[model samples]
Target: MAVEIDTSAFTEEAYELLSELEDSLLELEERPTDIELISRVFRAMHTIKGSGAMFGFDEVAKFTHEVETVFDMARSGTLPVTKALIDLTLAARDQIRSILDASRGGPPADQDNANRIISGLRALAPQKGGAAATETKAAAAPKADAEGPHVYRVRFEPKPEIFSSGTNPLLLLNELRDMGQCRVVAITNTLPSLEELDPERCYTHWEIFLTTTQGENAIRDVFIFVEDDCTLNVRLLTREEEQEDAEPKKLGEILLERGDINEEALGKALTPLGDRLVNAGVVSADKVRAALTEQRVVQEQKQQQTKAAEVDAVVRVPSTKLDKLVNLVGELVTVQARLNQISGRLNNQHLQLVAEEIERLTGELRDNTMSIRMLAIGSTFNKFKRLVRDLSTELGKQMELTTAGADTELDKTVIDQLNDPLVHIIRNSIDHGIEKPEVRKAIGKPLVGQIHLSAVHSGTSVLIQVKDDGKGLDAQLLRRKAVEKGLLSPDAVLTDQEAFMLIFGAGFSTAEKITNVSGRGVGMDVVRKSIESLRGTIDVQSELGKGTTITLKLPLTLAIIEGLLVGVNHDYFVLPLAAVEECVELSPKDIANSHGRRIVNVRGEIVPFIRIRERFAMDGERPIIEQIVIANVDGRRVGFGVDTVVGQHQTVIKNLGGSFQYSDEFSGATILGDGTVALLLDLARMVRYVEMQETKETGGA
Candidate 1:
């Protein structure tokens, strides 16, 4: 029977490889002499070409071959990694993507564009010592450091049920042959008789002798996906041959190592007294031979350890699967919480004990599951390099992008949604924020401008900043723009922070003239909306002559958060623990001392505060002394007055649906152990609203 192969999977993988290929090409342009980067580009292209052909993407294979050929020249030091080469390769990468899309029955790509890129790639070859070449030939061929090909002896045996799982072992062997020289010998030790044979079962295995320059890792990669389904033993034949004088250990030493015989028995077995005993019919030769055979098997297995040790155990599990696992764990956590509540009410010691253990286990499971969904933000950060390059050229502004703290991790869902808002900010930086080269030079600044992007963990949230050392936001101009656009009252008084935030309002623009990058006033508003949709807040800071920095505070994960639960009259609200500082009592006398003011003095620092019952207009009597949760709201300390503190809760956030979409009071909600739904407060928006209301009241007065 013939098994069908899926070509779509190959195309998907090819797309990812092409993306990495472009990233590598861009990096190579910056560090043109990085051989490792060059090799990375080569390998990605190589895999795409090979896999493309196998999966019947002949056109893709052929097109990638042309790109791979240029990189081959790079690897050989014949062609240098010049700016021209990088640009051409980037164009080729795009062309390949287009071709892939066309292959999937999408719109056909322009042959003229593909041909032009191919022509440019071909042009790079003839300039060995010309304009494109930068380094000497000796410097190009760094791969020569690889000593030589290492010989390996590999034994592979598939279990009888291997065929049941639809694996073709021969295909694996063929892949091995593609790496280097190889030999195969079939072993049929367990072959059944013809009449009793089960045709569906795999009965034969093979001993493969392989020699490859790719090293043990490459060899092991062939069996990575199917390793557990088969028994694989790979050993370095060269090492064994070099250590030809490895002496055979005595049977007694082998028995001792295996914990079969103790020191007394081993000492007796080694001496002539043991031999005399065996000859005098006190011991059997068969027992001695069996121990020696066991020793030999252990010796052979030990020799195989070096090759096996190099392989890293990693599996690429799909994100959807991880999400499903998290969902199930979340449900379990809910159930465990309910159990704990029930056990407490019933006062059953045994049930309580069981529930406590489940609670501990559930916490660990929830943590591990969340970790799986956490990916470093660097990949998302690296993508902006291309954006910076292309946009800078388009705007004719000489700007360079520098990044730090790329390894900061956030939830995968957060990262995915973050890309668009980030792109908009970078675009704004390039178009509106950055000054032109001549203008920068006229102001005693360097002709080239700088845009910096960075991310860092702040409590339970990640802070990403996009800063530009170009033209700063003019507060006077922004305030004027606000009035002109009818976004604010003509004579309204605004603070610096309030003026800067007006940039996020709809139809807000400060451009002197409209341009393609961002003149129409839609991108900034959309950026805020998108960030806010992720339960994040963005703050803008600028100095007239200095620069502008936009900081985004987003939760680490949307699925689960560390929260401090608090209660009002009959309603409960959860504040992100990352934002919560400490709790203090707000006595009636403290309120009386403040008169009508909402600000409270904490340790000699006056901090503005919001009373939850008053803010929400809840019908409830005020407590004589209320617990005030002091949290940093957008970098400033603010107190949230609550009736009582409910300690910490592992809040698995649930959306409040479209009904509460426009609400500024609560971001989302979570279920409690007692089957109550508690709303999760959006502190940043809540605080902003409270301040806005105060401003309106003061203005009215």
Candidate 2:
């Protein structure tokens, strides 16, 4: 069971490294001469190979080792970074992922494709009697280190928290022992007494004398994962000292050389120096014994430069755990609201003060927890680079995907669900929106078309836009196609915006013919459904022969939001406060002035209003003066009239389930402080619904 858990960890790390590797490979293509990019590719592959071997992934290790060797050659300037090599390496990376997934009971990897990738890689290499076949064995053989068996001294002092990080020091030592003749001596002076001991903490440090043909770098590589968590220093012995292996050095000389004891103290120690020094307090007992052990064997090394170890600052956590934490916080918020309600009803000043304090703390906790799930959208943006690259090649078009504001953060759940919608939009842009290279050049545009994806924060919402420089959507053609397909009436006159929105209607397509990339008429419909599911709105803007821009306005999170609570008769509703502009009074006189129309004049601005009581089919006496919650709906000012305004709320959203699925009016529901369930208005959808109703009733007025 433990072994499986460890392998699971390695798999997760490999997946992340693979993602980073993909990004580096894509960037390396654009900056072929970038040494830093080359090194990044090499390091990612190297870590994957080493960790794979450590966790019993022999196939992963063997395959990745081959790829790592090629990058190693590039690192050493032996191989040039070429497009072909990058292509082959990407194929190899996919193979590595396949092997990892297979080990976890996934489908077996495609061996034929794997072989083709390896062959391609070898063909690109500078061959000497087929070196690729022998590189793996050469990596394990010590013949490459044919020089004299050099001696290295290593001091490893791990932090007390090392064991908790799932590192085994003994395995590291075993790896070192495999490299050469090695002796490990442990110093126990740091060990605490039993009463003070913590079983989980590491208290032992070690000094190692190793004789190996491999250089110091090979030894350092053994501790690569834990280097930041330990103090490690490795040095090589001088050639002259290597020849003096026949002579045993005294303890005093060793201590004096190490600067552990003063020369005066060392000189005062008598024969049988190690015990005498400890007795005289000239040096600690552990230092004397460590030196005596050094004398028994060959003393290891002199001073050499050391790498300054950095502190490890990141902790890997499972997403499921974060989800649980957010859920718990949501429950706490509900409880806090209940407390606030009780405090208000009791009319106790002390209790009210405590309730207010609890509310403040709960809000902070909610914000912090949501931020934990807020990942930069850049990670998702990168995957599309590969998609754009592959699709452009397939479509025989010269195109580029440019992105901005990738560091904009959104809820992880929002980002996860967003991937498919973005893919659909980009695919449509590439296949139908971007003209061929020749067509673009003839049109006096650049030969390469551009698809720009950008995100920005707007109030409490995020606006993501996908814009493409190509032959933009033709509203006339869209309207004609819709009429022919029975999606619109032949004599009907439609606005350009309405015609553009027709693409999202089911079974609507303007393509001349069907192709693999699109033209089944399903992509835009999927995009619309998906965005709406996340409580987001999509807008389209385009001009013929210019370009098209699709903008999606989305809430920053799905779990919680700042909402305006309003009441209508016996029920309540929550409006997203970000979209609420202001509130006004709608009196009976105001209704009579408008001649029974659901429109009002608010401070010289004419705005249409929806009667929430009538819209929801609730039969009750209307208030003499209703509060009209004026909100910005899709660039238009609209109002929702309710019985009273209920102020602001820290609303934890809950879904209204399948029973309410038939209506697109209410997006979701939330629990109020007084235990009332208030429905959240899908303002954009409701406005469109009302507009369609009015248009039909007035015969397209």
Candidate 3:
């Protein structure tokens, strides 16, 4: 029976390789002489081609093979790394992605585009019989051999079940032989008799002696896919050993290097080593033969050496599986909460102890599960490099993207949703924030503008900023535009910070004319909505001449959050624990002293307050003594007045459907211990909404 292949796995790996290929190709254009980058590009394409063929992505394999051949020529210095080459290769990478996408029921890739790229590459390739052709032939010679060919001893001990995975060891051996002059010896010590042998299982391993100039990485690339299922050791036989005085390693040394014998065992053995060890039950005949074969091969090359070993075990898991796991964990958290409520009601010591233990484990599990979903934001950052490069070229501007703290991790869900908003920000920076090269020179600024994209951890939040040093947001111009668009009154007086925020207002643009990229006035508003939907906030800081900086403050995860549960009359609400500062009592006398103003004095600081019950329009009389939950909104201190403080709760956020989705005051809702639903407060948006209401009440102050 034939084994069925999972084409989706192949497509996924191909897509990732294609992405890395694009990044490598772009970097190659910057450092044309960097051999490592070239090798990386070649490896990515080679892996895609090899895996594509294996998974029957015939068209992908065929197209990639052509691109790979061209890159191979470049790798060997037969072709120079040119901007034209990078362009063609990038186009080819896109075509490969399109092909993979087509396989997933998307639009078919354009065959004409693929052919054009191939033709362009062939045109760049060195032709036969000219000076360039002769130069190419000379360059094609083994580069490593220039320093003298190196010999290596390789041992491949494949897992017995390799055959079940559709791997053919013979093909791997052939690939090794193709690289250089190689000798292979198969060991059958573990093979059973016919009656006990399993045809589907691999029983044999092999030893290989090879003299090659492809370098170690290329050798390892041959075994890349099977590395996880086999014991592979490749050791260099130093060139000095080839000298007249150098000798092959001793039998004991060979055995030790093969891990078949230890130094102590060898020291205890007598002469005629192999026969002595076998007779003494220290070695088997098969092991002795394998060692002798290695000894003979080394004699031809006259060298021996050893290398240390390191292994990393990795298993690729589908993101869907992780999502299911998180969902199950959320359910478990809910169940654990129910148990805690029961234990509290029963007042049973043993039951309370059990509930406490379960609660601790559940919290740990939730953290671990969320950690699994936390991916480095760098992958998202790398993609923007291409966007910046393309936009700079398209708009005739000179700008570069510099990034920091890319290793900052966020939940995969948030990261995925974050891409569009980031793209919009970067595009705006390129089109509006960065100046054209000539314009910059005229203004005495650097010809190439800089867009600094950085992220850093702040408490339980990640702060991502896109800053640009160009003609910054003109606060006066923004104010005037806001007035003209009726977003602000002519008599309105605003600080520079407030004026800068006018850009996020819908249909607000300072551009004199519209362009394909940004002037339609749709991006920043969408950005604000997207960030807020993730329970995040966006801030703007800019100067007249220097530049503009947009900062996004987002939570570490959206799945589950530590929330401060508070009660307003009969209903409960949760404020993100990270945002909650302190809670205090608000007596009716304090309210009377304030003359009905929604503000409280904490210490010497006057804090503005929001009455949750009034804001949500809940019908209930005010409590004689209300509790005030002081929280940080943006950078200001604010208080949320509620009936009581219900303590901290680990909230598994559940999206509010139907009409609740339209409410800006609550980001989401969670189930309480007693099965009641508690709405999560969107403090930033809530503050803005209340302030806007007050502004209207005060006649556009």
- TM-score (all chains, Cα) for each model: 0.72, 0.75, 0.78
The alpha-carbon root-mean-square deviation between model 1 and the true structure, to one decimal in Å, is 15.7
Number of the top candidate by lDDT? 3
Q: List, residue by residue over 1-701, the lDDT tens digit for candidate 1.
A: 98888776788778878878878888788899775687689778878889988988787787777777777667655677898888888887888888889887889988899788877777677555522342233234333224334566577879888887889999999988865556676766467899989998998877676665456766788898889889988876454334434665566664455344467655554356446435645344444444455445435544554454444245656778988898888788878878988999999999999999999999999999898899999989888999999998888889899999989999999999999999989999888888998998889998989999999998778899999997888888898998888887888878888899888888899887888788789888899989988988888999876789999988889998889999999999999898889998888788888898887879888877888999889988988889999998777899999999989888888889888868867888989888899999988889878777777888741
Candidate 1 lDDT score at position 191: 79
What digit string (tens of lDDT, one per residue) describes model 2 on residues 126-178? 65644454364345432323343567778888999999999989999988886
Q: lDDT of each model, Cα atoms only? A: 0.80, 0.84, 0.85
When summed lDDT is taken over every stretch of 10 residues in candidate 1, the lowest stretch is 130-139
Better of 1 and 2 by TM-score: 2
Q: What is the descending TM-score order?
A: 3, 2, 1
Quote model 3's TM-score.
0.78
Which sections of candidate 2 miss by over 4 Å?
A: 1-5, 103-105, 131-311
lDDT of 2: 0.84
In candidate 2, position 15 carries an lDDT of 96
Against the hidden true structure, what lDDT does model 1 obtain? 0.80
